[model samples]
Target: MRVGGSEYQFTGTQSHPYWFGWESMTTENPSVVLQWKSEGTGEQHQQNYPVILQVGGGLLHIWYISPGEVWNKVGTAPFSARAWHKVELGIFARPDTTGWFQVYVDGQLVADARNARTWDDRGNKPRWGVYDSKIATADQTHWINGLKLGTSRADVD
Candidate 1:
């Protein structure tokens, strides 16, 4: 995967995360695995978007936009390069502070966030591939298998 170049492998609505189980097998790379991009105006005030899963610098980064037009890191874990890892993101979406998000690696709960303002008026949807990155020339090769999005955790398990 290249840092700047990308191809969205799958696209789905924000609600898909709630009733669905997300799973992917990937080798370590400093690139984005998935992105949930909200509507943006391309202007300075509206450049922010929603959730994204990125791995880089030996860390897995789960970032989501907050109310202040900023990207906030909600979850993170150490990366294991050259090995296949199963990653899962389970979302409990609520407009209020009651909403939560969870991250699992190899079926082990690594990060759980509560009272998070996960979405805004723009809404969210998934776009798999390389997302926007910090480096223009950073590139990587990753293998993915068993990528799934479905209505139950068992679907991915």
Candidate 2:
């Protein structure tokens, strides 16, 4: 069985911060996303723990409960979910298309850099965890939702 997704464009410039929840979908990476949808299409985990998704520079910005860490984390997918990974903001140098990118897990700042690139061979609404042949079939899935592009906290803060 399969499921279709949604099409929503945020109404704002680089001055609005978008946010979503872990109903069951997040971006593949946390370093380079700008929007989201609550569509968990892909693989199956031990169970769904839900996650926050984002994009920056060109990496997926994942904000969720790392499977095996002390503190939650925000990093690229294809990673484990059980460690308190440390993040360093200002990782980039000039802010991404969304103005600037920040990383936070379990309510903490990890990395915040600047870059002008995002995950878009198709546009702003990029797809993550899309059954990559590079990985494996059993590992095909994107696990987060609620996307926010063209905006961030700094813009409103």
Candidate 3:
């Protein structure tokens, strides 16, 4: 399955390291945001996709994916998975030099790297999102709703 005019593939083992189970999108915009909730279980993991960016642009896009706990990596309240969990993935482009990128889930900052290792980090600009296609247990699948894309604060708000 595909979304946001982006293309992604599950290139890892589906049973080990929990296999990156998530979604991937190819957008021409500088930045975007996505919100999702568990469809069946409680906490779940959503992996980020690889993107490429032009070094001259100095622009960064963030991929945010949750306000609730991310599978088991986040949260302390022990939220319920049967219910809906809200997540927002933001992609940000660095300043003038265009050397690094960032990935944020919910409202918490995740990472800023010169070389990202999400799937295949090709450094492709204007293309960022989630891509988790790992089929583990009988009741395992990454699902999220309420996805939105915004360039800046105003566009998202």
Candidate 4:
């Protein structure tokens, strides 16, 4: 899914709660599950995504990429394969130190980043699905369902 255009783009101090179910068949390293991408052009294209949620080495990780092209591993959570798992994510996208990101797995708070920078230039839009990495060694399959995005936890939970 691609969340761009005026209707879905977000920036500044905002609270977005997202809920989804994910099931992976391969323990592929750096299999990106979700991303918040900057919509800027030219030089900004070289900058990494504002945020990335991915599975690396059978574990879920949250990566925060700064405007200066720094990759920060903010948090990680346990991931179980071959079964659908509930994921709830909340992001406070801000360019300053007041920003934060939180992740809940199976109704438990697994990972969080507080007082961190979570925004980039020109705002961002979300994308979902399994991306990156080469899983050619085995037949790889990923299932994503019930994707919901809302202003509060109640709306998506």
Candidate 5:
């Protein structure tokens, strides 16, 4: 799916924050599966994981910026093009150090990371989509289905 040209299925406002989906990319190029920004003054982008599927470079990078910018790659695995994969992300509505995040592909725990804070001060939510970052190639496309959000994991699974 085109990122900038299309609207996301869910715009996680304060009222709704949980995000999850099943996606398949035709290209091994880097692309954003999901992203959330703080509603603070700068809209400080809190978290997003861009799936790196390049051969010998398969990694799930959890991007975050608190005191400083950092990309945490908690999992690594080569991704096959056009293969369906699952992803789930949970965040607290309010900013606190007790927030957590996890990643799963093909029902396997690829990356599991936790922290005291999942979001920054102010309300936080999700902008779920296959963001064509064009890091490897311009104008990339991805397929997404079973997109969901809920209070529990089962709700999205």
Candidate 6:
């Protein structure tokens, strides 16, 4: 589903945390469940989304793509199949080196990345669903629920 508008747009150095519930029944590798992409055009226009939450090797992986077109695996957490999991993500949207990315699973901090470029020229927009994977041969099915966006951990957690 598409999730973005003027109300959700990021301004100068703004950051936000989001929470969502996910359950997957398939062990499909590289099945992207969420992504933050820049819809505006400019450098790296053809590059992949700046941020992505996907399942690979039966684990939850957080990926960050830099402005230089480098895909970095920032964090990962063990994921159990056939069970609902609460996932919270916080991103400090900055094109410079001061940005950060964080991930929490089941109320436990899993990944915390600091002092990195986490955004592009234009702000990233959120997209949720089962993104198709080229290397994945089997069909995948997943469920997403209880999505929330807030300024603090108490608001989304």
Identify the candidate with maximal TM-score: 6
Q: List runs of model 3 lying over 4 Å from the truth.
A: 1-83, 92-99, 114-137
Query: If ranked by TM-score, best first, what sequence of candidates would result?
Result: 6, 4, 1, 5, 2, 3
* Residue-wise C-alpha lDDT for candidate 5, range 104-132, written one tens digit per residue: 66666666556635655444545554664
**Per-prediction tally of clashes:** 1, 47, 42, 0, 4, 0
Whole-model lDDT values for every prediction: 0.61, 0.33, 0.29, 0.68, 0.52, 0.69
The ten-residue window of minimal lDDT in model 5 covers 47-56
Pairs that clash in candidate 1: 1-140
Best by lDDT: 6
In model 1, which runs have C-alpha deviations exceeding 4 angstroms? 1-29, 40-47
Predicted structure 4, TM vs. truth = 0.77
Poorly placed runs, candidate 5 (over 4 Å): 1-19, 40-56, 130-137
> Candidate 6: what lDDT?
0.69
Model 6 residue runs over 4 Å out of place are 1-7, 15-29, 41-47, 135-137
State the number of backbone clashes in model 2. Answer: 47
As for TM-score, the candidate ahead, 1 or 5, is 1
Q: Which stretches of candidate 2 lie over 4 Å from their true place?
A: 1-6, 11-14, 21-98, 115-123, 126-128, 131-133, 137-142, 145-157
lDDT tens readout by residue for model 6, 1-157: 3356444655436545343333334344568888877766665454347778888777988888776578788888888666678887777766677877778888788878787666666666667777857765666676767777776667676
* Ten-residue region with minimum lDDT total, candidate 6: 17-26
Residue 130 C-alpha lDDT in model 5: 60
lDDT of 1 by residue, 1-157 (tens): 1223764333233455453334444444577887655545555323244556788877778876665767778778776777677777766554456666677877777777777655544555555666555666656555566666554566666
Model 1's TM-score against the true structure: 0.69
> Candidate 6: deviation at residue 101, Å?
1.3
